[model samples]
Target chain A: MAEKHNIKNPAVKRILQEVKEMQSNPSDDYMSLPLEENIFEWQFAIRGPRDTEFEGGIYHGRIQLPSEYPFKPPSFMLLTPSGRFETQTKICLSISNHHPEHWQPSWSVRTALVALIAFMPTNPNGALGSLNYKKEDRCALATKSQEAPPKFGTPERQRLIDEIHEYMLSKSSPLPQLAPSQASEEQSKTEEAKAQVNLENPEALPVGAEIPDQAGDRIVEEQELPVNANPNPAGVEASMESSSSVSSNQLLQKSDARVQNLKPDTRVQKPDDRLFTLAAIGLAIAIVVLLLKKFIKSTEYGAVFMDES
Target chain B: MKFCKKYQEYMQGQEKKLPGVGFKKLKKILKKCRRNSSSQKPLHASLAAKTCPDHCPVCDGTFFPSLLNEMSDIVGCFNQRAQKLLELHLASGVRKYFLWIKGKLQGNHTALIQEGKDLVTYALINAIAIRKILKKYDKIHYSKQGQLFKSQIQSMHKEILQSPWLCELMAFHINLRETKVKSRKAHALFDGCSLTFKDGKPALTCELFDSIKVDIDLTCSICLDTVFDPVSLTCGHIFCYICACSAASVSIVNGLKSADPKMKCPLCREGAVYEGAVHLEELNILLSRSCQEYWEQRIQTERVERVKQIKEHWDSQCRAFVGV
Candidate 1:
């Protein structure tokens, strides 16, 4: 593969890197390979996103990378009639060349394929080369998608697609044994239930939204809620300080008192005492004083260093 | 002597302003804390404690706070200096124009040179320090906290390269390169860093010291090629303008300015980074001046790509409106 392409070209070098990475970290979700004749042209098979009508589907697509490669987003055309996107047409997606302004050079073919799978279940919103088929139609197409690889393009491209489909099949199990009628019935019930949950709490529905639109303030409010809920964050913080001071040995007695006040857990207290004893035996000098103080504090041994600095 | 003294002064001033103790004092305290933590780890390891082994209150509460505080202080000071340097450079044009009208036109080359040289030195030393500390933290913790903190630093606009003024500094050096002819001393002091296209990849190598050389790759993380017409997102990741626009979903008509405020930086995943994207015009100028042929080719191709995108976008809009 290295000898076949001109390694001197930066685009080729990057494409080769992606090819190498894809081979090494083979994913169960999707499989991709560049065309035999052109390194820029790739064929891929992606598992349908779960929990959607498209589930159990094996969608095949072609990726045509521009000469500049990573600098430019690739054009994606799905040959399979998944019902989400028009067959044999370049899909206008944020991750595709049709929306080149949304492409990041850092994103590789792997990332794009993952994004493509994720986009399968979204409301196309009249995006160019997008289709909004009925739920039943989509499910029917999905089941059909896995029956055979869509016959398109050259025989070489078709062969690549077939191999990808085979690989995807081996990675996944046969779709759950469900009568089509019963499966559709269950799906409709779940869909209605999902709508009820969304209507009850519109906030929870964003989790299922394709593009997460989390406002900056909402995140800050979410973060502040925990702090607000925990009334003794300062006390928890003070315990932390005292424990650190225990290691530093400057204000051990003071910190120890505060630590005891905050956390009276004898079990939690035991580990620190044990750790100090181990340190005293190993180092024998600086921590010996700390260990002795802790021992005295633990045993209430005449309050020797307790009154002293 | 003056440049070195100014550099030290700036560093000391920055160190003094850090929360809690001064930088040197914090450094000493952290050194002791590190030693104590190292000693504690083996003892902790020997014991069969079911508690979280990695948790160390002393290291986390005391050592990290001081180190991170000092790091932020250094970054904040560098940003201020960079801003000041830019202000001075920008004002020079107005000052020069006034002088020309008064028939006394002369450049303030000395101040620009001094500020530029000091800024570069300051950036090199402070950047090295930050990298070293992060590396040490990661080494000691056996975690990638240092790596994660870097992105946090960037989001805060405290990243060294994130400053828009660095672009101006690059322009200053480029101008110096052309005008100064072959003054090796000036080049040595001001041009401590040089952009090289070694192995057909762009890398900026900075000779911070005789023994210490830092090489920063200039490859667009999106494209794995030399950055062309670079723009810096607010999160401080540099990418080609077109690439960034594509990532943010902002069309050429609206520009990056109108990109969704929730749009996250592709590199750091920091939201709203696109809204404040800096064009890096000066760096682009410097790049174009140095690599004329590559610049020409890129500009030609980019023009064609941009026009094609505009046409396609309008066609889509027409189809949507006219129902064709």
Candidate 2:
């Protein structure tokens, strides 16, 4: 109720409504919010699309809305150190204010964000606020993007960005567990559902329309979505982070051994010596056992002769 | 809810083996979701066994219940909007395509570059509407199917923008609102450019402003940018002429013609390439009209590359034949 009162301006109210809508049905690709002081100025971040040069990258940017927003287009500038767009410069885009004829009242911030993510990989072609970086440079910047704080937005916005990035990384680590094996299971389940529905009506599963990912992954996602499920997402993230680090440490150890092999002095050179010594000791024990067995057999024959006399 | 029930009944009937016609297959089996489900579609209230032409009722069905139903009208409204835009695109596109094809075959240079810009307004509107509808569907139903629909609709959108026959449709381009060039050959700059840098490197240096914000979603995948001299391959993937030629190892002199009819597309290498690829007229018009200087430079570059490729091919063949 208090939140509704805070937004007295009609345009501000509309912007607030959009924020609420986005929160309820958050996109997997990006997230955005207006600032506390000014609803017109929004901060946004997007996950670069998978399989592209921008993959695994988190790009941060700002959108400045006019007083007559839907009537007028917004201007955008990327603040993050993305190799694609220049920081602190208003970029020209069809959705951006550079083209008023192209702007329609129907387009919202959501549309703008989708277009922004999609545009990141395209050649800049000498466009304003556009960057044409080499793939390797962009890739290197992408790795840096994981930790680079917001250089342009406020401190609060930067904190939100960090939290969201942490969430994304933690979410991705658990995703590989669901890939090929579960996809096949989903295919079979779909077929089974179809067959069953043909005979009778669909039960609708009592589960909402969610496309159930692999069984375990789906549960984890559900648990993560609710408000009080964890109460502290940061804690869950920390544990997942530590587990991932331990696995990586094991991999690093394997690489370390190979690296040691390059230095003649540091190398553990006698790897086969223990195995050869063990084999020799086992051979000697077998010979002693054979001799003992022969002696026992001769003693038994002599005792038999004394009994016969 | 009522629509869901009727759809279920219809689907069951179709899947059933009609006891009379066991092995004598006569009727066409309309599989569900053949047309991408997420693309905007109209509700027809068809009593044709309550089943849509395709099977998936949620995405394609016309008869879902409406009491306390928030999404039915929203989806219907989006479908209407999309249908209107698509109709405009088809009407303008078909006429221009035929004219361009005639112009190409008859050697009419004037007609080839002539102004026939099909507007991108409807396409943009359709995109926004589709995005909203997909979001609404997800919000109401909480389904993962919405995610799948998104990619399906996105691919469909790309196909629409890169259609070979359609020409440029300028949207929100402020500079081109009143500006008109007299000659067809003179490429009028319809947009403005901005320059900026990052991290002391030549970072984010190139940015252009045009009629409207050109959604990167509509851009071609191969060029990592706008579809220039856009060509629609047999495999449904679109690319610039120079890019496609290089990918197929065919020079612009010989064009996309292949003796082996089996040359594969670079993107979907499994699909065999078509000899005569379709050029997107409107995209070329957009490229030339808005970015005239860049377009002219590209033409010069292509011409030089074609000459080099042709000469190289002949030299290699001749040397091999001569046992050198």
Candidate 3:
């Protein structure tokens, strides 16, 4: 009753309201419930995002609020089989006010939970209160979690879960899903695009066309065949004599336009894609300039000879 | 008249009972009353039962005679000199008995399960006192006990070093001294083999190292990055304190930054960042170093960049004003 008495305090009230908001509009991956009798004590269940080792596994944990309420942070203990956190161990987290100065009382239970869910999948290089398990072990544990019974098997645990489930179900917006497989696919695609752009000038490919190698090979071959066959002695000489000076001037103007657009894209796109695009654009400009330079040099030579004659 | 008045009242109350009772009836009533009273132990007798044994199995005799003899002897030995000797003898016996019991319980094990520094210190003091007494009495030579005492002292020292509170105290000492002299920018520096950046800054979580690499330990992996609002990866790896801020995407509409469904770990090619990431505390020590460095560097870079930008802007303005 004394514990319940403090629930009306501003800090506790704010956290409770936040929890209510989280439940009403549950994140796609996790849900949490505060104890009705004791608002400070909360239980959380998170559904691992699809494609992750913990995908489909539900993790349960306890959040113990400090008696000082929001002034001091809460502590966490995991009760379920999570690959990251050790089962039934209180994990020391920065946001939990375990590290006093780091805690932001403005950060509610929802903030802590959201941060927690998002931090999964990182390498636990120097973390305290983090458990190290083999990938296989983690995956196995995650799979086995489905069959693992809840520790709080009493009416209380069931009621809490039911309440959370109902709340999550009622929510129109789902928690953001961190589907690892999908992310990997997206990452791979970006990487592939980057590799292609790096290897060949992205600017060489006409806008919205396939990469230059795949798109322009047929056109390039067709042009090459005609040039190879047309070794005409007299007609070539006549054309070279007349139009050589004009073509050299046009080549110079085209290269100047390319030089202007060579600046990197400052737009806030994904880092990897942006880098790739920049590299591709640079290469494409370089190739175009080089080709134009050769054409202009040959034309200028012919024009000089015609002037001398 | 007062006595006669009381006698009259007693006689009046006893009027329902026979004044001249039969012997058989009186004897039966007396036996019943005796049996009823004997069923329960008297309070005083029960209290005495604790210290005084009712029967002596060794002598096959009641305790009455021995108790009487002991009481008389105790009274006789009440003189100051005799009482002091008796007290010393009793104390010696108690000490010897305790020592024997402790020896049996401890067997060959000298290690004590000391949960706290205070308890360890107390044990060490007691051991020292015992050693001194043993030597004073010529019960055991100093050489014979020296090694054992030394080992116990060393163990206590090791425990103190291992204790986090003690380490923190030591850090405080170092910090205070260092700050006074102004030797280094920070009190201590944390180093780690790897780093994770959130929002291009470092986040500290020491626990992450425990899970990932056992051999190569780090104080903080994400050093040099200023982790403003730190978040942890599910694997317990902490990153730019604020990096998770964006990854979780806390919004006014969303209430708090919940992990994006599509979030992946920045370090490991595998695993999602948002599924079960937590902020790690142990890594904070390392982050402190990184944060300090990051801020210092940021300031330096920003100053230079600002100057260059201002100069360029002025130059461009001059050119435009001159119609270049």
Top candidate (TM-score):
1
lDDT at position A19, candidate 1: 61
* Stretches of candidate 3 exceeding 4 Å from the true structure: A1-8, A162-309, B1-324
lDDT of model 1 at residue B241? 86
Residue B271 deviation, candidate 1, in Å? 2.3
Check candidate 1 and list the clashing pairs: A101-B245, A101-B246, A102-B246, A102-B247, A103-B246, A103-B247, A105-B222, A105-B223, A106-B221, A106-B222
Tens-digit per-residue lDDT, A1-309, candidate 1:
211454435476567546644543456677787775677898888888777898878899899999977767899998889889998889999988887667766789998998998899999999999999999999999899888888988896777777777777765544333346977878767766664453334224221122112211111111111332222111111010111113111222222223222321111225786786566556755577888889878776556556664
Q: Which ten residues in a row have the lowest lDDT in candidate 2 chain B?
A: B197-206
Candidate 1 residues lying further than 4 Å off, grouped into runs, are: A1-105, A109-309, B1-23, B31-61, B87-96, B99-107, B134-151, B154-157, B161-164, B178-191, B221-226, B300-324
B94-161, model 3: which lDDT tens digit per residue?
36445545657875112111111112222222223323332331221112333443344333322121
Model 2 over residues B55-84: C-alpha lDDT tens digits?
A: 455444421222113233333433344434
Best-performing candidate as measured by DockQ: 1
**Model 2, range A73-152, lDDT digits (tens) per residue?**
89998877778889888998888999876665446788899888878888788988888888898888777776754665
Write candidate 3's Cα lDDT for A1-309 as tens digits: 112233223344345334433422334356666665555678786655445676556677788888655545788877876768876767767776557656644456777776776666666665766877777887887667655435564586666655454433332122243346988777777766664453233123221222123211211111111332222111111000011123312322222222222222221235896687568667867998999999999999999999999
Q: What is the C-alpha interface RMSD of model 2?
A: 26.0
For candidate 2, give the lDDT of residue A278: 56
Error of 3 at B312 (Å): 60
- Candidate 2 residue A157 C-alpha distance from true site, Å: 3.4
Supply the TM-score for candidate 1: 0.48
Better of 1 and 2 by lDDT: 1
